[model samples]
Target chain A: MAFFEAKNITKFFGGLAAVNGVNFRVEQGQTYGLIGPNGSGKTTIFNLINGYFPLTTGEIYFGGRKISGLKTYRICQEGIGRTFQVVKPLKRMTVLDNVVASAFLRTRSKREAVRLAEETIAFCGLTAHKDKLAKSLPIASRKRLEITRALATKPKLLLLDETAAGLNPSEVDEAIRLIRKINESGITIIIVEHIMKVIMTISDRILAINHGMVIAEGTPAEVASNHEVVAAYLGEDYDAQS
Target chain B: MKQYSGAILLLAVMLVFPLAVQDAYYQHLMILVLLWVAIGSGWNLISGYAGQVLFGAAAFFGVGAYTAALLSHKLGISAWWGLPLGAVITFALALPFGWVCFRLRGPYFALATLALNEIFRHIATIWESLTEGMVGILVMQTFVSKVPYYYIALGIAVASVLTVEIVVRSRWGYYFVSIREDQDAAESLGIDTLRYKSVALCLSSCMIGLAGALYTNYMGFIDPRVVFSLHDVSIAAILVGIIGGVGTVSGPAVGAFIMVAVMEIFRSGGFGFLGKLSSATGSPFVATLTKYISEAHVLSFGLLVIFVILYLPNGVVGDWPILKKKLLFWRRQATV
Candidate 1:
């Protein structure tokens, strides 16, 4: 049975449908990649699934329990943790504190939360920058801080939104490796990314969307060969093997 | 070790301030400083930490003062019970406003709070039968001297500062700061931003209400205009927080001291130098200054605000850490 499922998920802002009639499922501990063009609604789908926005019409199930329309914090308590595309770190707080804030949901004790936050910071290679304000970190490290913050919640299902957006090639490679390590730690992940190379390398299965509708869904190689996926990527001439 | 010792020394100095300044007038000024320090710090809890920036704090303060006055005069009750009752009512009154205002951002929310304060003032004024309208209520005041009031004010000040310190260092404080920094980010991190904000406002309103009760009993009066005046409730409290430090624990305390001292200096005829300047121009500039300055300290407060926001954005206490760091570096260079 699927650990999480979204059936006929539809979201409309005013009259325009931002995410139209989408269905997807993730098995326990599996890694899935969501790929789409600029307005393909990948982020919207993530928002709907994470309970950040209410679905105009549809249902979301987590751990075999219906979670649609639940408050965002309640959904987080149910073990669905997410990172934002824009990376909203607490500007006035230290990087360690940003992570510690997330860690508070798991444990109310300050000492325990600090310990977990420190461990998670080290895991994300952010120990050196722990005392620095979150706003002062470089982009890559800020992204990593966001990841560590989400990891601190100890969620069963993690949603990462464009985590590798502004990274250099080597940084993107490192992000992919860290993501796999997260999965190996018994957490399921659904990644929405535009970096094709990272997507193809790290994704066990791919779900592609265009104009708020699913265009293709399959294994990395299979989805790469699909005609709609090829057209969405600008042309068939673009190398998918990369 | 040095920082710890410095904190200890400061505490010692604070304990001696009342005793060293034996003049009744000087004691009165210190009492006012302690009062503002408590009320301003409480205001900072929701406005500074949660980023709500409420301008309706005076409304709660007035509500608490009136409630205590009415209970004591009309109902013949002690302030100890009246204080908590007044706080409960104010906290309840805050919920609907907080619920509606939380949805608004920046200027809109500020305007909402300001409007609410006006509405509260109007209600207190027109409800003359109960509130005594502008005539105000007065208690028997069997005690004559202002000395007892000073200690009472000081005790409340210490309590308020300690409460703020605890709330800020706790998990609730972290949640509030997170909400201030980024509301959407805080929500995603599993913080119920709306609930946290409401809770903070409740706690903040109660503290102000307690201060209000204390004020009414000390003055032995509760006039609508005096109780609901935004000058002391909003402007003074806000100026204290901003000038001292908006979010830091010591910011509001330091701000209260500076604001009280400056206002007292101006009020005590130190601006006589302006009289000499007026003799040359014959514009009655000194007269104009004395008249308006005596009426309301708003203009001077406004200028101070502009100066602080422009040059001292981080506030007084917020700069301590950075200044200490700079001083340490200079000392090292000198030794070398």
Candidate 2:
């Protein structure tokens, strides 16, 4: 049984298929990458897997249990944690409280929740700003807070959507390091990133999609070398450039 | 220590207030202020902390008041028992009302609550068989003295404040705040936004309802207009919440005092201070001005709300720091 699988997932927004008939599986502990052009339904697929939206024509399973119909929060309790493409922090709350609220999902004790929040915040290099308001944090910290908040939920499978989107080179490198650490901690990671450096360096296997359909699925090098993936990204001049 | 001292002082003052001041009118004002505290605290729970922007506080309050009135009129039960019973009946009103209205967010929810206030008022008025129509149900006062009633109101007000403080400190409070900040983010993080919202509404409604029951017992009279009034009950509740500091626990207590004082002062021509001045001066103009001011009390209340919105938008407690800074800056300029 797959650790996570989306079978024949399709979604429509008034006769337009935002995501169509996409099926994929993630093995336990696998670091999977998803890449596509803008508006190619990358985040839409993330939303479906996490149960943010009901699947129009498919089923999603976690540990072989059908989960496509569950609410987003229920899926989180079932051990699937996710970060938003656009970071959503509890703005008025302290950064520590933001993580503690999610950590409460697993533990009933406030002390335990606090412990988990502090540990996760420290891991994200946010210890110094623990008491600061989430809104007052810088963008890089806000993005990291989103990931840390998701991590505190203690999920078996983690979905990170554009976690490294707006960072500079140094911050992106740091984000890549943090993501690798998360992946190595025995959690299955499915990441959606437009940063080529991030996608190429982190993913053990990469899946390329165009118009919500998988165009190529293989090792990072294999997916990068595929003609369809290249054409979708660089246009017909890709072969001419080579 | 400093944080608790003010509360302790307030507790001491309230405990000795009735004994210190034997004036029935002053005691009556205190009871009204305390009742507003309970109602405003409830309103703050949903509208302020939970971010629901409720406009139908009277719905819960009226339901609670009617529950007490009905229990006595129909079942021959003590109106005192209606205190707890009122909350239970309010839950009946809130469960369905929250389930329906929480589905609508922002200003739409506000409009829905206003509509509900009207609906409840009409139901109480038109359901003459059970409610006894416009004649209104009258309950006998349990005591001839105002002291016992003041203490009862104080106890409930204290209970409500403690409840709010505890809830705000607990995990449920955080959930309410998260829903307020961003419902989508809250849901994605595994919080049931609707369920938490309903929980907030239930707490708020029951508290407001409890206040209504207390009001019926104290006033010994009930009418749809008096209990379910849009301006007097609903808007007054909102004003208390906002003036006290919408998101803070202690805010409504302070706000309640200011609100009552304003209402009383304007309604009685500065509590008859203006009347004294007018007569002492022996001027027709001063006498006429005093009468007009008393007559325009409601307008004065409206103008006060407008100023609070323009200047202290976050209320006294929430914007205390800004208020302090402005004050200090002016003082510094004077010193220079």
Candidate that scores best on TM-score: 2
User: Model-by-model lDDT, in order?
Assistant: 0.85, 0.92
RMSD of 2: 1.4
Candidate 1 chain B lowest-lDDT run of ten: B268-277
Look at candidate 1 and tell me the lDDT of residue B327. Answer: 85
> What digit string (tens of lDDT, one per residue) describes model 1 on residues A1-242?
57989899999999888899999999998889999989889999989987888899999999989999998888888898999999888988999999999999999999999999999999888999999999999999999998999999889999999999999999998999899899998999999999998889888888999889999999999998888788887755564543
Q: Mind giving the per-residue lDDT tens digits that candidate 2 earns over B11-53?
A: 9999999999999999999999999999999999998899998
For candidate 1, list the clashing residue pairs, or say none: none
What's candidate 2's i-RMS value?
Answer: 0.9
True contacts kept of each: 0.80, 0.65
Q: What lDDT does candidate 1 reach at residue B328?
A: 100
